[model samples]
Target: MSAATVSSVPIPSRGWRNDMVAALFWLLTVVGVLMMTGAWFLLALASLEEGTEQPKALAAGTTMAGTTLWLGIVPLVFAHIAGFALCLVATTGRFDRARGVLWAGEAVIGASLIGLAVVLVLSGGQLLYTPPDYVP
Candidate 1:
């Protein structure tokens, strides 16, 4: 057959879910960076200020926001990591079944991560600094 006689081949397209997961991956990564930067700035400002009202609030707020942001995106990252691990396993095992199980595990991990974040926020946990009630 000549080059001119060749026909075009069909291209495979990804599903909406795959597209959504990709978007979330990029979005979460960017958000995580921004959140961390803002948290650092707030914590620094809180340290620089010599006050009981604004500085204390800044420290607490940054701690909560930063922790929540980090916790929220961690499972999404693990999900991707798990997906890669499954890909390695798929070299020998049943890809379809393994992918389903890995995705389900990711979902559970994501849900639990969210719940943990909510609990942390509600509990008003602090980090990088000590509470006033501390003896040290």
Candidate 2:
């Protein structure tokens, strides 16, 4: 075989699920950041709202609630992380099994991301800029 002869690259067989999972991984990554950021902001605002003196007291309580809500995403993040591992497996030559895991993770991640988005939005409280009378 000459150097010019090209070797065939092994392509991972992707099912609908695998594609979906990969999509979810990306989607979840975005949502996770948003959720975490929103949580931090809420906590910070609580500190500000309480003023300099009782921050320890106020922050503590709100932090607990935020943490409880934030904690819900851990498993989904883990699954999505594992889904990435499965994707690596697909790259390395295992497509069939990895695909199933990847897609399952995708669904989980997607659902979790959506949940996080919803939670984050709810947790965000009312939009401060808008007046009570304002509706559009």
Per-model clash counts, in order, read 0, 0
Expressed as tens digits, the lDDT of each residue in 1-136 for candidate 1 is 8865685664333232355444554455444444444443344334334223444657677433344235434544554455444333332222345554554455444544554454446445432334366454
Q: Write the per-residue lDDT of candidate 2 for residues 1-136, one digit (tens) a residue.
A: 8655675775546543466655655565555555544544454444344343344656666433333234334444554565455444433333566555654456445544564565457657531222135356
Worst 10 residues of 2 by lDDT: 125-134
Q: Where is model 1 more than 4 Å wrong at Cα?
A: 1-17, 51-136
TM-score of each: 0.27, 0.30
What stretches of model 2 exceed 4 Å from their correct place? 1-17, 52-136
The candidate maximizing lDDT is 2
Error of 1 at 12 (Å): 13
lDDT (C-alpha, whole model) for all candidates? 0.43, 0.48
